[model samples]
Target: MTTSKTEGKQCNLVNHDEIWKVHINMELESAKSWPQKWGFLTESYNQAMQESSKVTDRILKLELPEHLRTRPPTPPEEYLETTQAFIGWRSAVPGLQLERYGRVQCGKKSFLKELGWALDGCS
Candidate 1:
């Protein structure tokens, strides 16, 4: 009887795991379909800014020759245009905003909910 009960519990656990996986996949699909609505763009931009900062630090550390340093590399104008488009989108949307320290900001409840979503069951 005990052995059968143990097997039953194991089966239940397996079913629970499968259900969690399905739920997580659905959440991911929804987020992917509307990434900006889910704050993915803000998070991505914050990460990119951090990476850009790291690259800038590395470049500053490098001791390049005078001629090499004379003309810094420039990004294509399209990059600026894309950034401007994002800025316009952000102004029109009411969603996640970045704090001065790169942290995401929204209402307390919304921020907590987002934090919970990000944690995804992790302690």
Candidate 2:
């Protein structure tokens, strides 16, 4: 009887795993559909991929000419103290306006669209 109960629990676990796998597959399908729905043409996608490859190749081939890559003369302790002071000043500033400005500039349209959808659902 105990063996039967254990077997039943194992079967339930397998079913749960299968359900989770199906959900992940659906999400992947939705992601693939999004770019197409956004009117991304095939040639555009290919061109973008080619540009990305070129950037990647350039990064991989980069060799800084001898003068630029040389080690800095500053002692490590001085560098560490300067970095810490900069970080402390940044932290001490309350309500960093630059961060808020960036969010407002980047997210204003999307945020309002989402907020409208959410408010509509509430009503």
By lDDT, who's the top model here? 2
Model 2: residue 2 alpha-carbon error in angstroms: 64
Candidate 2 regions exceeding 4 Å error are 1-38, 72-123
- Enumerate residue pairs that collide in model 1: none
Runs off by more than 4 Å, candidate 1 = 1-38, 66-123
lDDT of 2 by residue, 56-110 (tens): 9999899986433534566776665566765665555555333655444444455
What TM-score do all the candidates reach, one by one? 0.25, 0.24
Which 10 residues in a row give candidate 1 its minimum summed lDDT? 91-100
What is candidate 2's local distance difference test score?
0.68
